[model samples]
Structure formats: structure tokens, C-alpha cells
Target chain A: MRNVAVRNLCCGVLLVAVLALAVWAGWVAWERYRAANRPLFHEIGWPDLVPAGWTPPDVLRGMNVNRYQDGDPEAIDALARMKNAWADAPAVKALDGRLVRIAGYVIPLDRENDEVHEFLLLPYFGACIHVPPPPSNQIIYVRSKAPLEGMMTMDTFWVDGTLQVSTTDSPWGQAGYTLQAYDTQHYEVPAQSNKS
Target chain B: MPGILSLALRSAWNRRTTLAFIVAAMVLATILLLSVTQARRSLHESFSQAVNGTDLIVGARGSNVQLLLYAVFHIGDATQNMSWASAQKLARHPAVAWSIPLSLGDSHRGFPVLATSQAYFEHLQVGHGELLQFSQGRMFNDVYDAVIGSEVAQRLGYAVGQRITLTHGAVAMPGAAHADKPFRVVGVLAPTGTPVDRTVHITLAGMEAIHLDWQAGAPLPGMHISAEAARRFDLTPKTITAQLLGLKRRSDVFAMQRAVADEAAEPLMGVLPGVTLDQLWELAGRGEQVLMGLAWVVAVAGIAGMVATLLASLQARRRELAILRAVGAGPWEILALLGLEGLGVTLAGMLLGVLLTASLLPLMSAWLEVHYGISLAGLSLDVTSVTMLALLLAGGVLGSLIPGVCAWRMSLSEGLAPRV
Candidate 1:
């Protein structure tokens, strides 16, 4: 009985050691897998306030941003399609002159007294900084009634404003939409939750 | 099973000196294989991620890789500068959304000084679509102000508001320093893990201002203009080494490239950075393969050492094997015991290698990033590495066959002479 007990004790210890190693490896693999497929954002809260007639921003990017052909009629046609794509983008007629809230990083075009009133609001940081700005549709020209203080370039902000679907060309890049913002607050992303 | 393992452990401990040497060989071999693979993978990744978002690199007629090296990586000097007129004309093209001109041929303390317009800060990109971000201060707005990269700032211990002077040429030769015109540090960019982190940036006006009185690469006699007064004159740059172009549409890249190549104003060349980078990888891939081959040879030698030690020990362990046979252990059990012992050493060696790599990476990661533009992968083993180690253990077991057979024969022959 004592011999059997010693044998069982050895087996138990070996099994536990193997299980610990296996668990650690599995956890690491699962974390890596989750990182690979993480969603771009969680709700960005756009649809909650979007009017019945309006379309989401990604829909515009999907339409004509990824594909284009150069030369002759195809070039002209592609340009037209791009133009129309922006015009019909966010295709919500109701969003025009409607009050909305959005978040983006600032690309200051003009500043005064360390304050920013006219700037490009970008969906991501680094846009218009050291990299080519994203598609015009991805940028918004924001003009604030009250100057936002301590506005550093590339700082994120949540702006409450009236949304306008229009295009404006700046020295830096082009913006397909405009925002007459009344309130701007610093932006922060909540800690990511492990959904899987 | 426990009895077999206990016997193997006691036997290995009895020859601990030889066994220790075998373990050390396995450890070195494992480290060699893992590091070579890691280095090759990271080198490929960092190189490919060097340039992105820019549609075309336009420069005076030159090799595509050469232009890429000089313009994007600051690795080589440009053969010739395209006329500033041509650069402006390229910028004004209808399909061009933005253009960032690059003017090289200057250095500060061995770090290249990149003279470009504000557009470089506004449009140039690095790995994975990231734009340059200032860790402190802001972009240089005056001709006498400069922005340094993270590596330059850390190495030289410079901070915002510090002053620096650049040399006229790429190297800091005596009397080549533009000491008459010292620039204030207006900004410092965050660590980028690219060549950009080792560069110093200044405006086009800054470049022209420093050379205002210089002719034929020497300062003109009796023409010392103060940095403040130099700003009074027109600092319009007449030439630039290269330009990165961003098009209104991605499809226009090929057309714009052809136009630049066939440009009548000057003999210019244009290349897609991504395509040229792929060509560079093809050239580098062969060297990486040779390194990996050498590492495998080391691993094979290590396995041979393990086999030799076990085979040589068979004569001394003959009475021990006979005692096992007397206790009813079969020939097949003797083989299994020897194979298991080899596998245990291999597994222990692999674990030690992984721990050593993991510990060394954190200490060396920053140094590697600053020097080689390589951010070592984190400690967790990837599937490929884990699979490789498993195969290594399998090979170690196979290598024990000669020793296993010798032990089996000794056991069968000496079963009756166990007392010896």
C-alpha cells in the first residue's frame, strides 16, 4: 500500500506540473488571438444619435475609397464616383444642421493664444501630422464659436456641434464635412474589456 | 514507471560532470536557433514597415533602391538635387494631394539633418500609418529653430530650448561646423523605432539660411551674416534632393510615377516605396537563410554530444543495467529508460534557453530598438518556436538509439553477474 501511495504521489506531482505549463501557454495564445481580431471600436456611440435618414461614416469609405482606376474616361469616372460618394455619404438629409456629438483628434490649421478655433478633426491620431491625411471623407473641418484652450495638435476631443455635409480644401488636406462646434471636451477611451 | 525514472536520475547524477557539459551544449544550441529566427523575422518586419501611405518618391534619375535609401531611410546621400522649380511643379500637379520635399547633405553630431518644409511634419509617415508626434514642445516655426529625434535627444542629452549647430556635410569634419548659425531646439519627436528616430529636422529656410554666404562648399570671405539678419533675406530653396508625393487617389500612383519618370523638365525617377522595399527583401533574404542554416548545424552537434556521452557511459553502467534486468526489467524497458533520460535533458535545456531569452530581451530591447530599429518580440513563444523546440526534443530521443541498444545488450549479457 505504501509503494502504491508513493507511485500515485509522483504521478500527481508530474500531472500538476504539466497542467501548469499548459495553462500558461493557453492563456498567452488566447490573448494573442484576441488582440488580432479586436474590433475597431465599441459603438463609438454614432448610431444612437444618428437620424433616420443618415448613414454611418464607414459606409462612405466602403463605397469608393478602396478602389479606383487611372487614365482617360475611367479616371474621370472614378473622380465623379468619388465626388458623388462623398455627397451621398452619411446620406442622412436629417443630419444637416442637426446637433450631434463626435470624437476625433485635432489637426490645428490656425491657433491663437494657445487656443484653437479652426482645425481639422480627424478620426485617428497622426493624421495630417507626419503622414498623409486620410481620405477627405475621414476628416472634418471644425470651427468653434468659443476658442478651445490648451489645444495641442493631435490631442483627442469630443465635440458637440451642428454637422454639415460639405467639402473644404485647406493648405494641409481636404475635409468632406464641416462642424460648427459649440462645446469641445477632452476625449478618453475606456479600458478594454475581455469580451471573449 | 517511477522506479525507472528514479534509476535514470541516480545514474545521470553519478556522471553529473559529463551530463552538465551536455546540458550546457544543448542550452547554447537552443539559444542560437531561437535568436537567429527572431532576428531574421524582426529584421524583415522592421524593413517592410519603414515607409507607408506615401504614394511615390520622386528624385533625380537614380536607382530605385538608392533613392529609397536616401529619401526614406537617410541611409545614403542623394546623387543630385532636383531643381526646386521641378519640386514645386510636381507638388502643383492636379492629382497630387500633398508633397513633402527632402533636402539632405547636412549633419549635427553625426545625426543627419533633414531640411524639409512643414509639410514633412504634416504629411510624412512611418511604420503602420503613424505620424510623427512630439514628445515635447512643437514644430520649428523659425529658421533658427530645430527639431531632434528621440535617439539624438537621448544620446546628446538635449532638451527643448537647447542650441545645436549643424555641419555643412554629412560628417563632422574640422571647420565644417556652421557654428555661426546655432539653432534652438524647438521640439523632440517621440521614439519611432525607425531611421527617423536618428534624424534632426529643420525647415527649408533654415537650410538656405546657413548656406547664404557659402559658395563652392566654402564660406565666402567677409560675408558673415548674423542668424537674426539672415532671416531678412529671401530664404527660398533653389534645390531639393527628393520629394514624397501623396495622390488624391491611390489608383493615380502608377500614372503619376510614369509622368515623373518621363518628366521633360529634368531627368527624374519615381518609385513606389512598397515595391522597392520588397525588392530589397529579396536581396536580404539569402543572408538570413545562411544564418538559420548555421544555427541548425549547431543544434545537430549538440544532439551528437548528448548521444556520445550516453554511449560512452554504457560500460560503467553495465552492473546497474544487470540489476534492473534481475528485477525483471526487459530489454525494451532499458531502451525506454535511456530515451526518456535524453528527452528530460533536452526539455530542461529548452526551458532554460527560453528563460534566458526572455530575461535578456527586456534588458536589451531598448538598445536594439535605438540601434537596429528592431523591437524584439515579447517573451511569449510563438507557435513556430514552440513547434521547433518540440521537434528538437523528438530528435534528442531519436539520438539516444545507439546508447539504448548498447545498454540493452549489456543488461542481457550480465543478468547472471549482477553482483559484479
Candidate 2:
């Protein structure tokens, strides 16, 4: 009778060990599932950054800017005016301090070794050079909590952060929008193309 | 289980000579893999720590990478020097908070000599805004005073009062020495683990004082200005190699770069140090990847050898395993015995490999610091390293199981009557 009782006890311990392992594995799988189904931050698009019913100031309205010759005074004056207007571009105040995820091209500002600690995010590629910089509202100055590695200029990334609609002096004189990013992931185009 | 393990240990000892070779191979493979990773990491860290807190590097129009290498790292020569007038203009620009002008093309005992202002000591930073600190004395107070880096002082056995002469060019040519204007070592910098530790610093006025009578890379035929008399003349610098700028606002960097490009006085280029450094890494990244891949291949070969050695020994152990089966041991016991031997060998190799790597790091770091001015951090078991070790362990155990299974089948078939 004692031998039978010891055998039962051994079997019970083995069963408990196996069940504990299974429970731990199940918990890990469930956490992965939840993470995949629901992202940490709400994904936002470039259009959502601009406030509803707000439009850019048309500096060259009814004037054909291309017709002017190079070094023309009138054209230079118009260009200066347009740049000034863009520099003072308005930002959507409601989105201030909101935790969100947005994707854009990177223009690194500061680096420590191979990692970038600060950068500017633009909605399009080659926005900082060859073409005039976008309006202040369109630029997002990002300060990463942890330095980002293997990131280069113009690399597209989906950055998650708290977006602030504050206007600070920029290369363009004055710009709005800053992000304190907690996470940054390389951006990839979705395979599905329903709208197209 | 203890009995099986003891049997396994004794069996392994019987083939100790053969197993030792396998362990040595594993040791070498582990060292190769970990050293390569460590070297790559430290190289990047040392290069980036050379310069920090500076917003822009402006130089004469040329390759951006070349400009950064020469100005920040003192690694290469500049194609042309920007006029001092242009540097002053940029310094006076509203957006610029401060500027440190750098004049190169001189050396002292193979160490590059940098001629800058007092601001360099105040504003220049290394390794995350770490300011330059003096170990011996203060900044140069006179045109003939100089400051030496830690490595320069230690290697040359120089002190605060030691007097040193500068060479006109990067190499120490026969007649290029400025023997007439020997500088008094006013200060010695603390160790920074960057190129600064291998440099010699002097004031711009001192650099000008030495070259007052020299023109077009050579001293004039008849003019000889004594060090004291040379200072009496206007010691203003005409040109400089490059200038490091700090902007009032971080956002004004792009604008400053554009403004520097548009300067009407001369053709100058401004580059973001971080961006250029990234480009440099991208250029060298392919070579680094090839080296890492080679290390992995060597590790795989070492693990394969371990498997082959165990499998070859299995035939000789057939009779022994058969006897154990005849005596009261089961097939499972025989299998566990072989597996335990394999685990024990691999575990020993890994531990020894780690110890060897840790011991060699300081020696390797010293060599690199003397040759390349790059300092390496001590051995650290970060997540990546731990993960790699875990994967290697798994691979080793999985490889050993193959021989164990084969031995189990052999013992089951040939019990008590082994194939001699």
C-alpha cells in the first residue's frame, strides 16, 4: 500500500510540472497574439496632421512662377514671400501631446557613433535638399528616447511618440511640431493595394 | 542519472586525446566570433566619440567624408584651406552660437598638431558632451605655449615644462622642423580615448608665429624671425583647415549649411558630422559583414568536428555499451551517458573560450590605442552576446544527440555478444 501511494505522488508531481510548462507557453503565445492584433499606438497619416478646413497660403496665386527668368527681381521677391509664408505655417493645436504613430522619411540631426539621437521627419523623400523645405507644420522634429541604430538619411520609419504642436525656430526661421519618440521601426509598404 | 554521468565521464577520459582536439577547435571558434563582434563595436564607438556637441563642420569645397576625416579625426590632409575671413564671417553669423577654427598640416613626433583658439578647450566635447580637462597645467597663455595629449605626453615622456618643436608637414622631413620656435608645454590633457589623446594642441597665434617668416611651405631665403620677435608682428592667421560650428538653435543647422554654401567670399562646404559618419560606415559595412560571416562559418565547422569525433568513437565503444546492457543498464542509460559526455565537452570549451577572450581584450586594446588611437571597452555580456552563446549551446547539444541515437540502436541490437 505504501509503494502504491509513493507512485501516485510521483505521478502527481510530474503532471504538475508538465502543466506549469504548458501554462507558461500558453501565456507567451497569448501575449504575442494580443500584441499583433492591437498595436501600442494609433496609426496616423500625414493628412491627419493638418487641421480640418485649413489651407496653405497661395503666394503665387494667378501668377505663373515658371515664366519668370532666372535672377528676375519679381520672381525672387515672390519666392522670398512664399518662403516667409511657409516658415510661419500653422499647425493643428488639438493634436498636441497626443501619443501616436506616424511614418516619414528621416533627416538626421545628431548622431553618437552609429546611432542617431535626433532627426527631422518629413512626409516625402528629398524634402530638405534640391527642393524647398516643406512648411513648418509638415516637418516633425523628433528626439528619440533611445538612440536609433542603422538609420540613414531619407530612411523611412514609423515613429511612435507624443506629438507637440509647438512652434520653435527652425532652419526655415520658425517651424512647428515636435515629437518625443519612444519607438521607431523601419517602414515597409503594405502588400495589399485595394485603393489603387 | 549520477551513475550514468560518471560512466560518461570515464568513457570520455578514455578518448581524452581525441576529445581535447575538438575542445581546442571549439575554443578557437568562440574567440574568433566574439573578438570580431567586439572589435566592430569598439571601432564604431571610438570613431563616434571623437567629436560631439558640434553642429557643423565647414571646410573648403571637397568630399564631405574627407573633410570630416581631416578636421574631426585628424586622419587625412585637407585639399585646401578656407580663408580666415570666411571663418570669422560664419562665427559672426546670428545663428552661430560659437565656432572653433582648426588649422592643421603640422606634426610633432608623428602626432598631428592642431592650432586653435582658447575656445576649443571650452567648447569642444568628446563622448557625449565630455569637456576636455587638463591633467597638468592650464591653457596656453602665450604664443609659444602648447598643450599635449595624454598619449603624446606619456609616449614622449613630456611634462608641463618640456619644450617641443613642430614639423611643417605631416611627415618629419629633414629641413621641415621649426627649431627656431620651440613651444613650451603649458598643459597636458587627460586621457579621452579618442584621437585627441594622440594630438598636440597649440594656439592659432602660436602657429602663425612659427610660420611668420615661412612662405609657400618653405622659409624665405634671407628672412629669419626669432620666436620672440615673430610675436611682435601681426600674428593673424590668413587661412585655416576647417572650422567646427555650434548653432544657437539646433533647427538652424540646415539654414547655416545653406548660408555657408552661399558665402560670396569663397567656395566653402558645410557638412553634418553625423550624416557624413553614417556614409563612412555604409562604405565599410560590406567588408565587416564578410568578416562576421566567415567567423560564423568557422564556428559551424568546429561543431561539425565535434559530431564527427563522437560518431567515430561510437564503433569502438560498441562492445562496452553491449556489456553495460548485459549487466542491468537499459538502452536509455547508454544514450544518456553519451549525450552527457558531449554536453560536458562543449560546456568546458565555452567557459575556457570566454576566459581567453577576457584576458586578451586589454592587450588588444593597448595595441589599437598605440596604432590607431581607438580604445575598446571591457568584456560585457549584453543581450546579443548572451543570445549568440545560447544558440551555440543549442546547436552543440542537438549535434551530439545524433551520435547518441546511433549508439542506442547499436547497444539494443548487439547485447552481450558485441562485434569485437
Candidate 3:
């Protein structure tokens, strides 16, 4: 009887001790974690480089730009649609040289649209207006020398002087993609027949 | 059953001195479990509320999380500044219901100085569309006047008419201070248990005023002016970091976002607050999960300790068992007596846990609101809670039965002889 009693007593002490240690260890670790987790508010300092261009519409200022990952399906679909439209990009061989005109969404035709005259060419249906803006889903730039009126629709046609692809970042499109335009024309959306 | 429970109660009461210590341990463990759950839930809700009713947060160009952090919580500094012109243009959009302009890069003491329009109070809603209320004075009335949060007032002890300088960062260092213009506290907001409580809110004009004599992050080199003199300058903020927009139609949010991205004027982006917050929660939940898991382990250890205490006492309970058997008690009755004791202890300890948790709600609320931008869920018995208690009670009873079964077998083998 005394043997069992002694054994049980030792087991009780061991269990309690181990549990107490676990509690203490957990508490110590939590305390250290709390102390180490001082808010990063005060520590914010100027970065070595200011972002170089119109930030991707998906990105925010002051946010660590390195953390943004654009995986929006709608934006991807829009990009794919534009890529499809640019396949033949309408007979560049037919109108080579002599300042020919073509229309597309004003994707920054050049990388430095903010500083230089460049931006990408997108489709007409995707224009975002003040009343119903494009989902902050894509970085669609319009290289219009003139102010834009109404929706920057996906189907609206614009004239690009020639294909000059400059990779330099635009003044405003910092840490972003800029496409420049040579002279571009904004085209009205053409009516489509309703064929089921 | 009463007789059996009476014997068990007497036995537990006799060892109550030791069992009571274990109960205290359970009380602490329960607090750890419940408090962590409450803290995390509250923080997420409170954070979502600080931005109130805005559908999207638009900024010059950066990460969505960055915009959410500064434009909403004011926890971090904004890296990019948007021209107030750009914000105004976005506001001109037909779909926009309202837009609150915000300028970053200024602080009052350690609290962030949010240069926002009064539209924030008009639009800001918290915890089920509740409007912001004042604990003391009203909102900022004058251009240089400020409205502080409850925590800011309590911590700095500033009141109406008390003047304070603005700092650029989260700290109170004078080097980061905009000492040229001192603003009076005209209003204070009630405690919202969110980042709003820790921030200092001022007019966008106020932000532009202090920054008028500065360029980038410094005073315009070789150009200087007094705060009073600067007030004479036009206060229209030429640029701002971001704008919060509410649309007439929720469906137009995406389209508007795309328009801003495609702006012929500037490269800009707008992000939905709910979507951004979810992304952040998924990313930041890793550390939180680890912490919660550790606390859960403590709760388990507490339950195990209770079981172990009951198990250990069985050996000392051998004489009591022998006396019962000799006095016409069956082996099953002896087991029942011990089982009831374990069950009673669990119920008692849990009762104590409920009391401890109830008493600690205020302290927990204060700690969470000040340290983390979370509001704690109030103390109430919910489905999850009922389920947890059921598991603990069932587990405790079953665990104590282990020793009861052993004693029953031994007593049957030895008849009236003491197993110990």
C-alpha cells in the first residue's frame, strides 16, 4: 500500500511539474513574442529609391511595394483579351512607314508614359468611367494629348503613330509599367449586330 | 445516487485544500483559452470598423495592404502621396457616392495625424453601421483644430483648447515634429476599441498647411515661415496620399477601379477594403495561429492536471473504499463514489473559471484595445463555448473513471482489504 501511495505521489508531482513548466514556458515565449512585436509604425523610414512610375492600380503608396502580388482573374482575362486583339494588330505590313494610324485601349504604349509619350494599347469595351469605374483591376493608361471625355471604354479606338517600345519608367508610373503613345485617335464604339 | 454523491462530496471536500489549487490552475488556463479567442476576433472586427463605410481605398500606387494599413488604421506611414487633384478627379466619377480625402506623413506625438475631411465622421461607421460618438467635445470645427481619439485624450490627457504639435511618424521625437503650427483639441471621439482610438484626426487643409513650408519630407531648403504666417497661405492640399470612396452602386466598384487604373491623367489604383483585409488576415494569421495553438496546449495541460490529481488521490482513498465495502457497499458503489467526486470537481473548477473570466473582461478589453487594433467579443455562452465545456466535462469524468475502474477491480480481488 505504501509502495503504491509513494508511486502515485511521485507521478502526481511529475505531472504537475511538467505542466507547470509548460505553462511557464508558454507564458515566457508569449511575453517575448509580444515584446518583440512592437508595432512597425515608428520604425518607418524613407526607402532608398522612390517608386519609378504610375504604380500598378492594384498597388497602394507607402505599402511595402515588394509585398503586392496581382492575381486578379478579371484583370488577367482583360489582359488576355487585349493580347488576342493585338494578334494581327491590323496589318502593320500593309501600312508600314508614313505615319499610319490605328486604335486600341491606351495601354501605356511606352514604359515611360508619365515622363515620355508612351502607354499600352487595350481594347474598347473595358473603359472605366466616373459613374462606373473599371475594377481597380488593371493598369490601363490612355496616351491622349487631349483630355478624355466619358468612359475610357475598351472598344474606343485611339491612333498610335508607330510602334516604339521604350522600357524606361514613366515619371508618374513609378515601380509600375508605362506604355507611351505616339499620336493616338479616340474612336467611337461601332454598333454591332445582335446575332444570337 | 444522493448517498453516493454525498460520500463523494465529503471525500472531495476533505481533499478540497489540494483540489482547490488545481481549480485555480484551471481558472488561469480557461482565461488563456477564452481571452486569446476574444482578442483575435475583436481585433479583426475593430480594424474593419475603423474604415467604416468606405467601399474602396484608392491610392497613388502601392500595395492594397499598405493602403489599408495607413488609409484606414493609421498604424503605418503612407509611402506614396496622391495629388489632391487626382483624388478630386476620382471623386468626380459618376459612380462615387462620397470620397474622404486623407493625407499621410504627419503625427501628433506618437499618434498618427490623419489629414482627412469631416466626411470621415459623416461616412465612418463601426460595429453594425454605428456612427462615431464623442466621449467629450465635438468634431474638429476650425481648420487647425483636431479631434483626438479616446485613448489619445486619456494617455496624453489633452482636452478642448489644449494645444499640441504634429509629428510626422508614429513617435514623439521633436525632429519629426511640425512645431510651426500648433493645433487645439476641439473634440474627442468615444472609445471605439480600434486604431481610431489611437490616432489624431485633423482636416486635410491642416495637413497641407504644416507641409506648405516643406518639400518631400523636409522644410523647403532656404525657405521658412512661422505657423501664423503659414496660415495666411492658401490651405488647399495640392496632393494627398489616398481617398476613400463610397459608390452609389456597389456593382460599379470594379469598373471605377479600372477607370482610375486607366486614368489619362495619373496612374492610380483602388482596392476593396474587405478583400484587402482578408488577404492580410490570411498572410498574418500564421503567427496568430501559432500563438493560439500554444494557449490551447496550456488548456489541455490544465485538464490533464485535473485528471492526474483525481487519479493520485485514489491511492489515499483506499481506506475509505475498504470501510465502505465492509459496511455493505458494493464494488460498483465504491466506483460511483469516486466518479462523482471527479465530476463535481470539474463542474466546480469550471464555475470558478466562469467567474474569473467574467471579472477579467474590462482588463482584457483595455489591453487589447491599446495594444492591438481589435475589439473583444463580449462574454457570453455560445454554441462553440457550450461544445467546449461539454468536451472538458466529459473528458474529465472519463479520465477520473480510469482510477475508479482500477480500484473496483482491486477491491473485488481483495474483498475488504485496502488496495493501497
**Once superposed on the true structure, which residue ranges of model 1 sit more than 4 Å away at CA?**
A1-196, B361-368, B372-374, B416-420
* Segments of candidate 3 deviating more than 4 angstroms: A1-196, B1-7, B134-138, B215-223, B285-292
Q: Write the per-residue lDDT of candidate 2 for residues A1-196, one digit (tens) a residue.
A: 3354457768999999999999999999999997787546778898887777876588899888879997698886787677777665667788888889999998787666568888988888876454555665777889987989878888989999888876554446454788999888999966897888
As for TM-score, the candidate ahead, 1 or 2, is: 2
TM-score of every model versus the real structure: 0.68, 0.86, 0.66
Tens-place lDDT per residue, model 2, B1-420, is 455557767877888999999889888887888888888888888887885678899999999999999998887779999999999998988778889999998999888899999989999888877899999999998998999989899999999999899999988999899999999999999999998888899999999998988988999879999988987899899999999999866656665776687577899989888778778989999999999899889888989999999999888888778767766677776676677677777778888888999889888998877666789887777777777777777778888888999988887788778888
**Per-residue lDDT for B198-293 in model 3, tens only?**
778898778878888887677777787777787788888888878888876443445556657766577788886755665687787897899778
| Predictions in order: lDDT | 0.75, 0.84, 0.64
TM-score, predicted candidate 1 vs. hidden true structure: 0.68
- What docking tier does model 2 reach? acceptable
Better of 1 and 3 by lDDT: 1
Candidate 2 differs from the real structure by a C-alpha RMSD in angstroms, to one decimal, of 4.6
lDDT of 1 at B125: 72
Candidate 1: TM-score, chain B only: 0.93
lDDT of 3 by residue, A1-196 (tens): 3354457768999999999999999999999997686332211111211223423333233445344456565545555444333221111122222233444554221111012132333333333333222221123233445433222213345554432222212112112212233444457666898996
Q: Tell me the deviation in Å of residue B250 in model 2.
A: 1.2
State interface RMSD in Å for all models: 14.9, 5.6, 17.7
